[model samples]
Target: MKLIRIFFLCLLTTNALIAQTISGFIEDASSGERLIGAAIKFNNQGVISNRYGYFSIKVNVEPVRLMVSYLGFETKEIEYTITKDTSVLIKLHPVQNNLNEVVITSSPKQELSSIDHYTIPLELVKKAPAFLGESDLFKTIQYLPGVQAGNEGTAGINVRGGTPDQNLILLDGVPVYNINHMFGFFSVINPDAVSHVDFMKGSFPAKYGGRLSSIMDIAMKEGNLQSWHGTLSLNPIATRLMVEGPLKKDVSSILVSGRSTWINGLIGLGTLISNSENSTNYGFYDLNVKLNYKLSPKDQLYGSFYTGHDGFRNQFKFDNSVYRFGLSWGNATAALRWNRVWHKHLFSNTTAYYTQYNYNLSQELTSEKRYNATTNSSIKDKGVKIDFDQILSNQNTLKYGAGLVHHTFAPENKSYQNSRMDSTAMNTPVESLEWSTYLEDEYSITNKLKLVAGVHYMGQHVQKSYFHSFQPRISLHANLTSRSKAQFSYNRTAQFLHLLTNSSLGLPTDLWVPAIPNVGPEKAEQWALGYAFQLNDSYSLTSEVYYKNMEGVVEYTDLSAFLSATNIPWYDRVTVGKSRSKGLEVYLNKSRGKTKGWISYTLSKTDRKFASLNEGNWFPFKYDRRNNLAMVITHDFSSSKTLSFNFVYNTGVALTLPTSFYEGALPSNYVHDLNNPLLINYKFYQSLGDMSQRNNFRAPAYHRMDVSYKLTKLKVNGTRSWIFNVYNLYNRQNPYFIYYDQQKLKQFSLLPILPSVTYQREF
Candidate 1:
């Protein structure tokens, strides 16, 4: 029996020796740099290298052709014969003056339309390193051209010469007002719950209604079809927990995610234990939930809901006693959606949603004298839309949709100066109901020529204000060749609401006001032309120029009227104006295996002509910056690890600052009497220390760098992984806001450099 066992062991050992693997390393021929994570494919099998640029794989064939590819490097295929299972080395040469890769996502069988230029995938979102492991839909799109990030911590995206508000943000076909949590440092969408994001910068599709400048569509995850999956994350400021699973075999699924800051609570406890007065406290929390079910093979149902809140507190210590003050805000949203495929060529989707936002402030001085005010707002949008998509052929397609929306806008219930002021003193709620119908056609005239055209007719009725308007859009694409294309687009749009703010800082005082009878709907006309090219399979480049003309824009005569007055409509406190913007955008992208990154630069100018100010001459817009540049790169050391770096440099944003100090606008005794009812009017005479232009002065140059590293797929048993990330690695101070205090006669900026870390686990 012992002899038989020994013979079996010897046979097993011989077989193992015969199955020895072939391994090798890849490096850049020019720079001689080790190409970590380079893809090596042979015999229908592929494997990525480790950080040491080493790879090993077993194969039956002794001789095979190995295909090696990496971004910015020429793809090479080498044939080598293996003798006695020996390791081999390969080198790849970098392509000189290679064109960047034109990475786009679109469904198969759909005609490629110029209007639908690019589609970003959700997997890329999850893979990309983000702030605190939090994936932001808007921030991810900034990597593309025609999109710019205005400030740190702010999801402000300037696209095609338009402001952030101009971009229509939609979640499952429902509009969302504020997409920020914790003021603006993070986005509201939890990466674990998102399924896809589709953004269009230039051309507007007929299937989409509302918003003029751009469209951002987000689709939430439809739960899991398999068993169950969950993740838990921890950071210095917050902790997050999420879970997803199938309710039934393959019919139903659900996902839930929640995050909350423990810093404030933990710090508060520490202060209490030490018997010390609390000077500052900040806290934020958010929740997200999604569910999906398959009613039939052709029908599906989904529901999504989100809520978040932010608060800050401070206490002033005096010799006699302590004074406490606090400021807080909150937002909530919920949506339900239904999608049904009528046939192989027709598709439809329907949605309903609701959203709310509120702010509160409270202050106490020795208890006897206290001030408290709470302002709450809610915009309930109940709507239903039916979208029909037909594929006439491989070359012709049509997408059409119609929707009806009922808006109930509730302005804040204001209470001021302690209990002396009542909440009912504010204006009554305003309700606007609107309905729109639109249709678009995408035609491929030839293999090299494509066109997209659509129009929308909108009707709004509310409080004696009736508006009927038509928005038209058209885009053309001419492929110069397989590697190049030329495109042009023209669009017209109208807006029925406006945001009135005193400063560019976007303070709480900034009010979102609806259009009234006196204030006509804002109208705009925009045109753009562009060229795109692809070199090899790893590089893509694009250049575009755009122009926009707007009229009937509203500006305030006195910033205080937007806050002090009640019962009066927004038109009574604002003045109509005109504005224009023109810009050029250039972008390049390269992504393959180990190294992936892009460079984006924008040269633009925005100007406003306020007939009521600056003698009607055009001046730069408050948020405009003449030039902006950004670069980002990511390197994969292995299949489970990566490092990301980002750098941004831009010209200063337009600002308004006093040229010199002065006592007051009025110096003569009769000047005050002459304008008794008007306070101190400076319209008739030149100001003493005026800056000449409201946005003439430029702020300091803006620049910053950030780096992060991700570690994933740590295995113990089953399907489990881990991720670690750090934001603002070098701690570069990216100024968010700069304001001049009248009392101190000095400028103050908010938020210095900040560092954050997060740990995550997935199953």
Candidate 2:
């Protein structure tokens, strides 16, 4: 028995001696900080570290290379093999130069960072201060070149001289019809629900269709694959909450976020103070929710639902309620995505989604004892899309996709009491459909030359719509040196829908109407060229010039024409026109270790020509501004604190305000006129008129400054630190809009400076 035991112990010792083992401690070479949760891989077997930054793995084959990597860090590989148990330390350098470059994290985890373009990283975007403590996606994007904010508080932006609607906004790959809420005061997107934002401003790939200017792709969080984390915020406008965590260890996860407004309570308080029971009550609220589930490493399913409502009630039961309006709009989207890595260099993401948008309004009267009522209008849209991206090689990449959109315009319900005191009703129904496909390729011809070219073909089948059209685009870039580059781009785009609004205010009455058989689509062709040079690591200079020509544009004729049975042919009520825009943009960026900021200026002109107005002479558009300037700055007080500030100065927007009165004469044949000549109508302010067009009038010069501070890296008990923020520190009155009351015959300007504070915590 002793001899048998000795033989077994010898066999066990031999097996242990032959086993191959590898271990390492990963850390940052610059900071000398251990990189916890760093990934360490070898051949086909690998293991990650615990909180202490130590890892070990056993394999049958000898290790030829060891790769260690972490987010925002340079990847490093060591060439060695472990014949027996061994411990090695690995240090990785920080990629400083490329750290601020745009990254597409929506792609598969393997090579997502490789899909590179000129982008503003989220880290840099976060450094820019916001208004009312609310950080807006579109507002932040305006800091980058090739983008311009339209109006105050509105997320509307004009990219490369394109109309606001020309840019397509996508959420989780689903197209969003309208990206603005609260008349552009806020973006439809809830910042808490978004993980990454990708905006392609210059050269767009073929996979993205339906828009001509640019594409804003917003990606939601895939949930926390590691552990649970949550955030909550309370601000003047609204309160928000979010939660994300792993569903099953490291395999599955889920994410949820929600927000609501307390404006109703504010409205109630105002009513009580006035002590008027008949006064109108106005309030607005919004809600957002999103869910994501990871079925496997190669498959993901996500669903997002949003709903919002606004109402203004003016109760006068004894008499007629003069005006009562309620407007509501929202959408729901569901997407199922399948991602597969065909090879080390090729990755594929296939997605299918359903999207919708809706709007409704109703008005009634209790006075006049007559059933005088009108259901203004309601619009519904349904769509489906498919997108594919192909990463061929390091120098060349391709994208192609297709989609179908169907819009159903509900019949407008109209009722009015005629001279006989009888109510009459009429309805109008409109439906339109569109399908499109595109292909775009980005190629690097040489070390210094890059070219991006693509074409999109769109077909429209309108049961009651207009003609079919296509959009084409191309962009070229040349790296004169490592810090200086030159770029040029040309694009042609079209819009098949129009916004019918008489008031400049971005109100809900700004009806969206599709092109019909008689009315043609609006078209635009734009060209731009720019040059950039870096003086040093702290300062860079950029300049760009552009020109655009627009055709088949329409402007409102009758200021108060109701679009209903009375105006069966709404197209006839619009004036046909053409427009042109030319502009120059110059920017200087200063980025250093402790301080970062940018200064930008724009000089632009816009004009319109119509056959029926000004004898076909070109005139200025109302929104034409000669100059605009913005400055943003950020200072890092310490490793755990930051201060940010923003200032903007812009020439006033143009408007059509009444100037001088004209002389008029009363007809001698009229009963009241005893052969008397009276003052007649006349054109006003011709000498002072800068130009004449939809955007010809300009307001006073505008300027405002805002500031915010953040405190981070604190530990309260076992939880993480908090981020405290304050916006509009000095209370600058930024103009929201201007109103002209015809009855009062006076112009009134509205301005309000708001401030807010919020707290954020991460674990």
Candidate 3:
């Protein structure tokens, strides 16, 4: 037909003569903030920046040259002149003698655009290496490579083999259910108020959903709109303070931070040097806040809040014969956000959130007739979200979102009292409704392939039980040259809450439970395969291979005693299972020269099955570990000294021991008394023992090493620092639990060669 209408009018006149476009937002010229991944480039095409810093591109040429980069910032290059479609706002700069330079160049541009992502850079999570001197971003994400760490100065995490409530975590975008504090040896994020940390682990982009393995967003720190600042810290078990200013300078800003725990005044001065009358106490505290505004030039607004608490107390007296005990736990969150840009290729964000977690316990008794007890548990959430981003040219880009939540669970609530007045109470509250929707796209099918697909849908209602899920995601990349690349991913996740821990020690009497109608929701399906290169210019290397598969998994019932259960009804004691895991991970980063760190490894296997556990076969999965290793190193001996080291090794964890013992008997009509014929009885029996199957045995191979040193000075009203640490530098006695007592076999160890110190100041 006339050469198919002249090949569709020469492809619409060559896309209307080279369609042109460019878009932007990437600030931080001195605290105007914004700058989420930054790394735009122009002719050879590139893009990165989203998570609120926006960027879009589509060009044909007309005086172009644009570059922009980030990592300690400072790398811009501009030229532009694309006639009719453009919008810009670039600004970068902050590399003034970046610690006396030694950077060797290796801009992996945030892993060349995600697929099993990772992005830690808040100054390398505040220069890594810390445990008691605090700096922890979940303990530096457990030293990377498929994560795993929980039990040994905990900061719980266990990605590839899942657990730790299947990882969700979020902070500014709210959703943080007990990110730990004292009991986990600290981790309530306060790496100077944080400002970036991504981590995805297995391509799951469809705007994320309930969690089934990983996702840790976290982003805070939007203060200092151009001046006012403050900081102060001290450690040896906590103390901190922070502040930020400019409540209206560049159109508003605010930030506040707090932390506490002073070893409870050194345990009340060791009970006044052991002159005690019986006493015990513990403590924890946290707080953070943020607010920002910029109501013009396309609008913006934000507000965030966080709160934390932990407490414990015990007392006993001789005079009136009394005893008492108490325990507490906490978490709280809030968020509100806005942000708009409706044009330059549409962008929008809107959110409203609230979260809460709670726990409490108490006990009391008085000598002659009086007793009391109490317990409580809680969880709550209220949410709203809407997100969008579009840009349809230079090879597509889109993202969409929707959300709704309202949950309120209260797994246990009990009360009892005595004194000839009797009383008892039990309360169970559960209410739910959750919803989700998502969409994703990021095409670019050429110039070296790329594709990201998505879809997600979810719905859940409790009480009368209802559930739905549809997740599907996909990823791919290929660029076998120019520094290498190759990736692949697939995901499918679902979770309706479940955390029923029975000790790996991160305690708060863990329990979160949901999913009813015979307990359901909990599913995963992962798959990953990756490779990244870049060997020089300051190294880089990646490697992955994963496999998941899980379904309904939930545990607890082995006669359920999750920390002494009470008043029953936690889905009638849990137990629904099936699990599987597979792994092989490796990472090697180096980032630049004043000596940087990274080196991770993992090789694994996990298993589980349950028709009711054990006899259904499959075992191992008490954090099954086959091999795992980590190493981090840092060195910068000038520009204010520094040194750091961390080492880890694992391959042990899988326990369930008992193996042999016997003697049973008792019960011959209650020791023979059948109508008094020959009333002769003799009874004494009971010794049982014999465990052997589930999680068979293992637990002995762990290693640890840590070291740190830092010093800085230049205080004329500003910097000052000192940090020194040595947590287990060489005292290798790792096992943290095992017992038998009188029949031998005991083990138990928790942190030993400890030494810590910290002090800081900034103004």
Candidate 4:
């Protein structure tokens, strides 16, 4: 018995002596900003850095070669032998003299391994040609295949025939209810404050839910841990600034960025130009703040907050009477998170978040104060979620999470000063609870093939109504060769809330409705197959074909009913339908060399059918186009000078125009205007007539070219740059909308040839 005990003890001691735990953070050497999704490998085994730039791996204590690689950065190699557990920070430098260069390798955990995900590097966002002299992440994403932009200069996104609201956008693990500012011309997010962006259109993992078409996960910079840095940028209409520094050296950090317009005192440029007190001012401002503190070697705490406001105020004074109209919309979000490293292979993150979006419109009369009124719409969300990542081995990794969200919605509320009509509210204040849980596993069946499978269970509760769904997702990747690959994926997604718009304009007042007994949730299933190949070491080509089917999509049955005098229940004016979308996309990108660019083309078809609309026949979706093509190029002239060019061509959107008009009765609530007693609210206030079908006509094709030149120079304390941008360089008058006038069909364009310049300084 003594001899057996001695043998077991010796075996245990030997195992402990051989195993070693190595952990550290990966960061940029110059900026001291931690890098995410970096790959670290040794002895044919590897691990990826987490979202917070932490990594841990267990390995033998013998001498071995360690390699670290990150896109757009120089890879490093080291040889080391550790006696016990070791912790070290890995710093990487950006490639010298060239910022547009990008390279992808067939690493085991590269972005493409997920089979349809895209990891857009931050450098690309900074180098792309800006719209109106401002860099926009959503605009850059719209140039990708399978994604469509709404109107000229609009930041609205429609992916794979899905509406803008259908995309689940996240910021630091918290949802953003609204991403629009300046009436959809600018997104709420400040590009300089973001660290990384991940976009997925298909084959979504179980960790994501509540969206049908796409997911955009954005990570904010965690502040510099070594030193302090700040940047200030200016444009013709807006200015922005960013600051990041360490609160406690190597222990805590903070980052703050703010953007506000200051053109003649915040959009009073119009008043300045006209020199009148009866002018209008419209502008927006955004603020972002984040703080991080290390509680221990294995635990960290984070807090982030963001708020943005857009307001339009107009006042007109005529003699002794005054008329004022104001419109405002804003969004606020906050998140508190805790990150813990339980073991070398186990990591967890717990987060509590709150988000709110609100819209307000008011009109007042000085002479008739009793007629003053206000309209408001709002939505709020508070939720807590926890996630765990368990790296079992090199062949398998398990991910699981659960969340619970309490939602409050006030669709639309109208208040009047007169006591005769008290107040009116549509889809009045309602409360709901959303609960979800997910589990997934990534298994490497072989060195050439990988399989990822997951399941998500989500449900909603509202006033004795319960809606639930079990969504399954799967993806398969096969490496055909060292430089070529093939992949296939299938995904099922569901949404418990719906955004209801009265018209195709997609105004800020669009109502948000939860899943009730009268209306069910929206669900979608998608299948995609793709192939990718690398040519030489500078270029890559990827092609994919996909099909999607969606059910429980809600649409307005009668717009006339909405304009009636009496209020109508939302469910009574809407009906459910189904939609089908299929598409083929081809993309070719250049990664290295003096000139970098990409060319993408897409062919797609989307149709919808309703039992009570369009005579129960199929019709094209309003935003559906048959063909879209885009090209982006950036040329490095020298170390301090660069040029960028962007071009896009899209087959026109589908629309319906009334061939003729017929006289119709006005709404009962419409009151005559004393200023123009004979004139109506609109010239064509009569009913729409001679309309053959919905989405039966195609608008004219849209094509535009933009160019920008950037010159960087050394400033007093930092670096400064001037960006000269010319929108519509060739002066293409693209169609923004079509209208009928004097029995003639006319096309209306929104923008003209415009040129703008921006100056940026970094210190």
With candidate 1 superimposed using the best TM-score fit, by how many Å does residue 315's alpha carbon deviate from the native?
4.7
lDDT (Cα, 0-100) at 204 in candidate 2:
55
- For residues 40-146, could you state the per-residue lDDT of candidate 4 as single tens digits? 88876676887777777777758856798888778999777887767778898877754445222222245336546777766667667777787888988888889
- Return the TM-score for candidate 3, rounded to 2 decimals: 0.36
Q: State, as a TM-score between 0 and 1, how close model 2 is to the true structure.
A: 0.77
Best by TM-score: 4
Considering TM-score, which of the candidate structures 2 and 4 is the better prediction for this target? 4
Candidate 4 local accuracy as lDDT?
A: 0.83
* Best model per lDDT: 4
How would you encode candidate 2's per-residue C-alpha lDDT over 618-726 as one tens digit per residue? 8776556677788877777775677777777777776665443333443445436544433222122112322234443566677777777766554663233233444
Error of 1 at 181 (Å): 1.3
State the C-alpha lDDT per candidate. Answer: 0.67, 0.61, 0.82, 0.83
lDDT value, residue 192 of candidate 4: 87
Once fitted onto the true fold, the runs of candidate 4 whose alpha carbons sit more than 4 angstroms away are 1-21, 58-61, 83-87, 102-112, 263-277, 317-320, 368-370, 418-422, 426-428, 503-506, 560-566, 659-688
- Looking at model 1, the pairs that clash are 99-539, 100-539, 100-540, 101-539, 101-540
In model 1, the runs with Cα more than 4 Å from the true position are 1-116, 123-129, 132-134, 278-281, 313-324, 362-366, 417-424, 502-509, 558-569, 665-688, 717-753
Report per-prediction Cα RMSD to one decimal. 14.3, 10.2, 23.7, 3.3
Distance from true location, Cα of 736 in model 1, Å: 4.4
Per-residue lDDT, model 1, residue 148, is 66
216-269 in candidate 3: lDDT tens per residue? 998889887888888898988888898988888888899899888888889989
